[model samples]
Target: MMHEHIEALRQRFLHSGDDADLPIVDAHHHFWDLERNYHPWLRDVPRIPFRYGDYEAICHDFLPDDYFARAGNHRIVKTVMMEGEWDPRDPTGEARWATALHQRTGLPSAMAAQIWLDRDDVTDVLAAYRDLPLVRSVRHKPATVPRAAHRRDFSAPGSMRSEGWRRGYALLEASGLMFELQAPWWHFEEAAELARDFPRTRIVVNHTGLPADRSDEALAAWRRALDALARHPNVWLKISGIGEQGAAWSVARNGPVVRDAIACFGTARCLFASNFPVDSLVVTLDDLFTGFKTIVAGCTREERLALFYDNACALYRI
Candidate 1:
């Protein structure tokens, strides 16, 4: 019944008028230059266990021209580049590359630089990013287990729960940078505590908390986790990475998750993104954003603008 209602609304929305002209600030995306830079996940022998499974399709170069061509008519006025995992040895290299890329292309206006918060040089790395103009935030995906069943035993060294990690995390506020977190829903409880502990540091939750399992039980737990995280004033959400593994993207399947995220965090705290190239494996940029437009069709124009553009500008300072 819910799917039918959402589909009906989606149909109504498509007929009402398209949002091709809606200016967008893509809050999350990535660019990788495989020929010049080394991304182990893409170039390595045994690929890391990826959620998208068999991602050989995205092993080549992806640049701004490629992005805007795929974007079609949607006016993407600005974008925040999530750090493409460049070699871990040189953490500041990706930000420098993005800065130069901006100088040449004027796309990806800002970036989420890569930094392992738990590393010994965390302060020095933060200081480096503080000097880079392109860096608005930094992403170091906290350690997490593959499945929820293994969470109890998942006491990895760099996990968000570790004191050592928290010590480094506390410095972001002074550095004037936000923390971009890409953890699954099971980790939100810990994330919420981190947010409360460091009320001054802004934290953006990537991928709608990664609700991969869509079963009734799983969704219930996901919602509960989202609720817990949303209680923190410092936490923000990027509405991307909601793609299902095998099933193709669709409004009926994903719209509710989008709506639920907005309900949990509200439009002011939410931002839209195209986790592109990675998501390109599941759906085209056009179709994925079209689904986003359809799902939010009932919202006021101001609210829609906030989701697609204004909120990202405010959050990323783009």
Candidate 2:
């Protein structure tokens, strides 16, 4: 009975035709080979049973061709590849793999490489990866860390404010590469500070600050942080990452939140991203994009175009 109920809900979201018109550029998507890699989190998280094998079972390996065939119905002209935590044992291997993927697929117009900001020699690391033709940004992914890894006062300024990270960011800025901010929602202020300090760097805020679950305080704090960050002209926000939070959230639940983000960031600085496969765990690709389109339905065609495609093209130099 419980399994049937879950199926019914999934079908409802899947069948919903909300993305008929938008010209999308999926700014966030991932691909991984579980066999060749080790995902520590996936090993323990029983809830997400979809391994690379499962992806193959469901859709034949979640490759670019599969993604284009399934999610490209809305006309995804370009996509930006976000790094899946690659074999951390070899650190630099992910970028090399992504570059190989770029050569093979030719869909990821830009690549957001994963890097460890805590590394002592981050400048050298940045220099090494920055030369890749498709490498447009770097993501440290502070958000994906375990909740226990964070402190109540994450803003108290220590490692985050360190010279090493800032210097590495400076190298990124100098290279004219964008910085994809992927920290938890609460770290918006810290992200904002980085934006302010590195005026020349383009900072793209992934997932509208990744608002915590439907708590009033979380929502309120997310709004306030977005407001503060919006003041910085260099900071842009992506309307992505919603579906992964849970399966219970729907267009009905998330539309207003996305609308509020558009209002705060303005269509020019905001781009729609389908944070794919990760999002697929919660909602179908079509449904996810459909929900986003529905949220921005009230906008004029020109404004909608910017959110759907133009903004991402410019941001990633696609």
Candidate 3:
């Protein structure tokens, strides 16, 4: 499926916009050592059935050089490393490894380290990751609504509404760390409610609301959820991973999602990211950014700059 119209997609979404030369601060991406990390999904599964179906192409090592080469024309001045779930028991290990990469390669100016928010020792974990030089945010894959395409349901029952989770969430305020969230569109209202409660703590939603169900009804619901979440000033939306879950990853398919998110959150509160390697299973970095550039082609230079770079730098404090 990827090979059939890939050339056509490259041609159609390939051309860069006026701000093509502008430096990009890739807000969401990962660097992993599958050997050192315990990523069961990447290690045990031979194929990724959902998010990025049959992930063989991207299942191997993807270091800094590989990412830079794939980024192609875009000048990736800096990036924020989204913590790949490595050894759940050793959450800080991922940050330490990424920080070493930062020293050696100088990419991922910030680290969004993962923490088990439901754990009793979560506060200590937060303090540990927060003190790391580049660590700016904490990401815990919140249990999102289940989709038919998924092989396993990783969502914990009543997590978003639970008292333990909210208590852990409050710790982010003390650590000065933002929350990098990942969940289905069905859960946005709960997310919005969290944003309202934690007005001081920043929350960045992953994907363009992760519209897994693409029916007109589903899209409308996703939009309504976005509207609800957008009302909170502390929340920001990340326009990446568009194709990661949405099987039909193309300019025509994703343009509306990105445009709608930017419209919903406005340029100031919105950001662009490359959910790379994971997204690499669907599209290349060049194609991803190219598609994004095409989506916002009609906007002014400043707005384009804001989406492609500035907003991420400010939000992540990179």
Candidate 4:
């Protein structure tokens, strides 16, 4: 029954439209070593049978080859690797791992390594990882925890006000590294404020700030926040992660949401990203990029190029 449901969802996205053979540069993705890391959330989720070994075992090694195969002929020439849930045992180990992967894959033109700002030694940590050839940005991931059960209820008042966190963010800005914001919808205002405050820092908002479920109020809030963020020319929005927010995974369902984001962020400030392994929880790589193509159908060739390839190259300095 579960397999049947998954198949139906896949077909819904697959049949949405023909794949437009545009060259793509996926801005965000992840690779993991089950043996070396612990994904506590995966184990706690009852619906998924995934374990540390299950990802590699079932996918035959979740490496660049696997990503390229799934991306097919889309010319995914570059990718920016994000930190998966780093092993708590080795907080800085994820950066080391990404460095190794960059050497091996020769694909992730750059990486946005994860750092915990809550830690006292975050400055030292960022300094250490900044030396890696592919390290271009740092992700504090403040939105990893949300206050609301659904994204609609989220607000970032208290979270962004942390003195230590703000100081760490200053450190990231001073180091000339981009800050990747992965917060829920409510945090968009705070994110915009951060962007405005740190004018020199390039802020990349992941998952279109991850809007709440579709509704007039939700759309209005998302638009308001997005518009505010756009006032800061340095802020960029990544159109990824909409599928996972749906009731059930389907690219067709995610299309409008992503389109709304693109419309708000515009082509230059907007970029396409495959949230990969995380997005794999919702749709396959082909379906994900196919959905992206559908959302950007109204764009001109130049606009499409910027969204899919050019923006990423410029953002990550690939």
Better of 1 and 4 by TM-score: 1
User: After superposition, which runs of candidate 1 have C-alpha atoms over 4 Å from their true positions?
Assistant: 1-18, 150-155
lDDT at residue 261 of model 2 (Cα atoms): 91
Q: Write the per-residue lDDT of candidate 3 for residues 1-318, one digit (tens) a residue.
A: 533343333333334444446667788998887766667667875544665556666667778888888987876777888987777878788898888888898767898888888798897887787568789888887765565443332335436767778778888898888998888877777787789888999999988778756678878878888988999999999998877453656898888888888888999989889999888867889988888888888887678777867798788875
1 against 3, candidate with superior TM-score: 1
Q: Per-residue lDDT for 1-318 in model 1, tens only?
A: 633553454344345445755777888999989999988898997778789788889999999989988987776778899998889999999999999999999878899999988889899999898789789999999988766465643557889888788889989989999999999998887788889989999999999999999999989888888988999999999999988878799999999899999999999999999999899988999988888999999988778877987788888886
At residue 71, give the lDDT of candidate 2: 71
In the range 43-144, model 2's lDDT, one tens digit per residue, is 434435432223323322356876866674675667898877665655667677777877887767788887776666566667787668778888775433
Q: What's the CA error at residue 306 for candidate 1, in Å?
A: 0.2
CA shift at 98, candidate 2, in angstroms?
2.0
RMSD of 1: 6.6
Best-to-worst ranking by TM-score: 1, 3, 4, 2
Order of candidate numbers by lDDT, starting with the best: 1, 3, 4, 2
TM-score of 3: 0.88
Output the number of the TM-score-best candidate. 1
| TM-score for each of the candidates | 0.92, 0.81, 0.88, 0.82
Q: Score residue 260 of candidate 4 by CA lDDT.
A: 72
Each prediction's total of clashing residue pairs, residues at least 3 apart in sequence or on different chains, is: 0, 1, 2, 0
